[model samples]
Target: MVSRPHLPEDRMLVEQLRLQLGNIGSSVIPTILLALLLVWVISNDSNAFAMRAWCGITILFKLYLAWDARRLLASEISPERARRLLRRKMVINAIDGATWGSLAWAALGTTTVAGSVLVVAVLAGVAGSSMSSLAPILPVFIVFGAAELVVLGAKLWLMGDPAYDALAVAAVLYTAALLGQARNASRAARRAIGLRFENLELIERLRVETEHAQAAHRAADEANLAKSRFLAAASHDLRQPIHAQGLFLEVLARSQLSADQHDALANARATWQASAEMLDTLLDFSRIEAGVVEPQMQVFPLQPLLNKIENELAPQADAKGIVYRSRETHAAVRSDPALVALILRNLVSNAIRYTEQGGVLVACRARGEQVLLEVWDTGIGIEPAQHQAIFREFHQLGNAERDRRKGLGLGLAIAQGLARALGQPLSLVSTPGRGSVFRVALPAARAGVVAEGAADAMPGPSRAFDLRVLVIDDDESVRTGMRQLLGAWGCVCDLADSIEEAQALARAHRPALVISDYRLRELRTGAEAIAALRAEYGADLPALLITGDTAPQRLREARATGVPLLHKPVLPSQLHRAMSAVLMGRELDSSFAGLEARRA
Candidate 1:
């Protein structure tokens, strides 16, 4: 047969017994001393009836002490019941005090050896009775007390006349030792109680901390979910106008006009460009803050990036009659090319906008293990105090009226964010009313590879193309603009405003490429349009989806579809690049199919 396991109730009982022992130990000496004193007084007196009465009172007092000790033990073992137990114990203590007082009177009235023995027996009985309530040891305690008395008497008799003095000293020492043991036991019990209280306090503190941490985690999760929803909705909503604007701009750029008219158109184009830049900045800042813009580090030549900056900013500086110059250096760097280019663009744009006279100069120089790309301008330089402030979002130094036309003051803020994202340090030094220099230090790359042609420079004449393209969007203006732009690019353009429209177009004429907006009217989306087109034609249609939403959910949805994604407002050059990539892929596939056909 298996032995039964100990239950929690069993453990509780054991703890209760231990606590009783501790309490008994604490009170034993005092009770013993009172007993001994009463006995000594009774032995020295001479009253038979009074001695018997004193013995009875002593027994009553000992019984009260036993009850009080039991209550104290109960309180220590289980504090939940301590208040009730303590009340009972206090009552018992009161009874004990009264009984002891009565016993003292009886001791004064009686005198006999029998009375003394009776008093001693009563005291030992009381202590034993307290212990007996917890366990079975009352008889043993009474026998032990009798044996102690017998030993004392024997020792006194053996020593004869001198033994009387020795016996007196021994009695005093025994009483003192019992009192000291009781005091020490009480102190130990109090220390244990204090430790238990401290443990309870610590547990409470840890419980509160755990609750706080859980609350924080819940709040963060909610915020993230909300952010994902916002990005999805915002991106879908914003992309429509951006996509339309891009296509419209492309159509405008292709239109023939006089130099004066072209200049006006250019200003209009700049306004669109600035608006697009602001949107891009907002999107990028959101991405960086959300920890989505992972840096793609690669070894790329720096000179080409600098050259692109010069080409892009030259016209703006010229319009302001400010000179634009770049000091070329043979340097390469390992960094995120796209992020670095963004940083440079913002710096160049700021320099062109602020400069009134001399001009802006961009230069690169070797500095130890890093290359410093610096943009220096002779403009309204920053005050030493305002240098750091300029990098904060939407901050402008001058009057609102004067700086209002320049654009939202997010350019520097975006530049700084991008710099940090790429793990590069961007620093500024300026002299008020003189000039400012903004420097970005990047890790240097090995000096062997040739630079790729500058991709950011203004595009040259369009290349001849015979590719067929389909444009699908819910917006009429977007479709019209795309039609005109693609027509100018030498591609036969088919426009559709819905999935149904796209399906009709695909059946009538098999298009080589499909470019669709993410959000459409009547609850239709770009993915749905692509699916419809593919169903009508084939699954192998080349397609690209464009959106302005920065929401993670929308991005995830787009990513899951395995379609090429471009954010709006799309630049003419970016559109061209995307188109080239799609066309190149289509050409390679066609060539492979032809080769397979011959083999078969």
Candidate 2:
């Protein structure tokens, strides 16, 4: 058991008492002064007994006020309790005014002082009723003055002594005017107290709400950090098997075997490809969660990216006996070409995975100032309730029964997150068992943009990388596999496991291309490696960064360096494509030469 520090009880009690005393002293002082004035006016008659009786009443009233003050100073009171105390004080003051008024009328045969004091007490009562009901005091004052005059006239007629009659009338008038002023002052005081109390209540409420919000935000931040650490660790471990498998596959692809053995190897390769795709999706989802995925804003023809998706996904759709097609009336848009491709890839892949016999269609239409890129499929559609849910992490609808082999329900989640990060909105309309349409609506970019070398357009196969390429990463398997893949594309390959080794290789080889992993040993990263390479080789040395880190800050830094980036468990085709696009500055095929030429 742990011992906790303690606070002294006496100190706590003294602080509590100080707060209460401050409140009570402010309310009671004014009431006591008004009571004394009432007693003085009533005692101004000739009878000795009446004068002594009025004096005794004044003394007792003062004593009661002092006792109430002492009670308030002895305890702490909350706002709710303070409100109750104010109500009780109002009632007590009203009773004191009624008692003094009754005695003065009985003794002097007039209701002069009694009427005026009664009006003031009633005004205080109105103030105490609630914080906002103090408007009735002015009318009550006017009535009190009228009633006082009637009573004074009756008293003069009954006494029939002209000597003191004028003096009595004058005194009654003076007292009435004084009490009227006091009533107005008390009303103002009550209003001030009410406003102060309301402010205190508001402050306390806001404090509690702020604390609660801070706690929730802290919890979310901690969860996100833990998730990033787990993904980094898992990606590191998963790469070892993937690297080994890639090496074995390359060896198999090169050997001459019987036709049956070759077919078996192809099946094995398909299974490996599927496993790799799942891993890639998981890594991407983690990256999206960490907010490391950034959009590269460039004006590329929209047709080429959509065509790439069509080529990539058409085979899968055909194998499943489902038709796949794309149509876009507006062919050019300014945005991150790679990010848009990724979003479309996921949408088309998901469409094919769910559709058993029917087809999938990708199309675009202009909506106001935006373009609505739509992917529609005749698959098992989502329930309206699950439309938004499916976009959340690890969410799947009826996946247990359908195609668990296709994926782990992360494709749409990644797509939605990427869209949001790129400042686009991805929305869906679906009915269970009917078809679904998923749309990515983005703002239109400027028209007629071009990349480098637009004048001399040539029609040819997309230029392949013919330059020397260097690969640097801490993971040996990843480094070896990348070296083999690049070497297969007819490019000379140099490999390193750290920045120091990369710098050495850059100086010795002066390679035409550089590729490095984002995370390395001792908190060093691929960005640092790229920086070192740039310093040794010139800054415009055509470099690319490969990373498994999904943190937003790292992504921003990578983007700031103007380097092409690919997240890990890198697909063979995506790697080949990214390399060609960055190194040659040409579109993939002759048909698409016009696309790149227009962009240039």
Best by lDDT: 1
Residues 380-441 of candidate 2 have per-residue lDDT tens digits of 99877787788877667667664757777888988898898888989899877778999998
Task: Give per-residue CA lDDT, model 1, range 1-600, as digits (tens).
Answer: 954333343333334444544555555556556555555556443554554565566565565566656655555455455445444444554454345334424542244546544543553344344333322222222233334434444444444555444643554455345444444554454455545656766799999999999999999889867865775466556666766776787687778889998998888877777666656666665555545555667778887777766766798899999999998787889887767887888899888888899999999999999999999999999988898899976687675774656856877887898789888999999998999999999999865654454223334455756877888877787778778887887889898888888888888888999999876788667988898788777788888887666665455565556667677777766667667767677321210111111111
Give one clash count per candidate, in the order shown: 4, 5
- Measured with C-alpha atoms, the lDDT of residue 428 in candidate 2 is 91
State the displacement of the C-alpha of residue 385, model 2, in Å, after optimal TM-score superposition.
2.6
The C-alpha RMSD of each candidate to the native structure, in angstroms, is 12.0, 10.7
TM-score attained by model 1: 0.61
lDDT of 1: 0.65
- Give the 10-residue window scoring lowest on summed lDDT in candidate 1: 591-600
Model 1, position 301: C-alpha lDDT score: 84
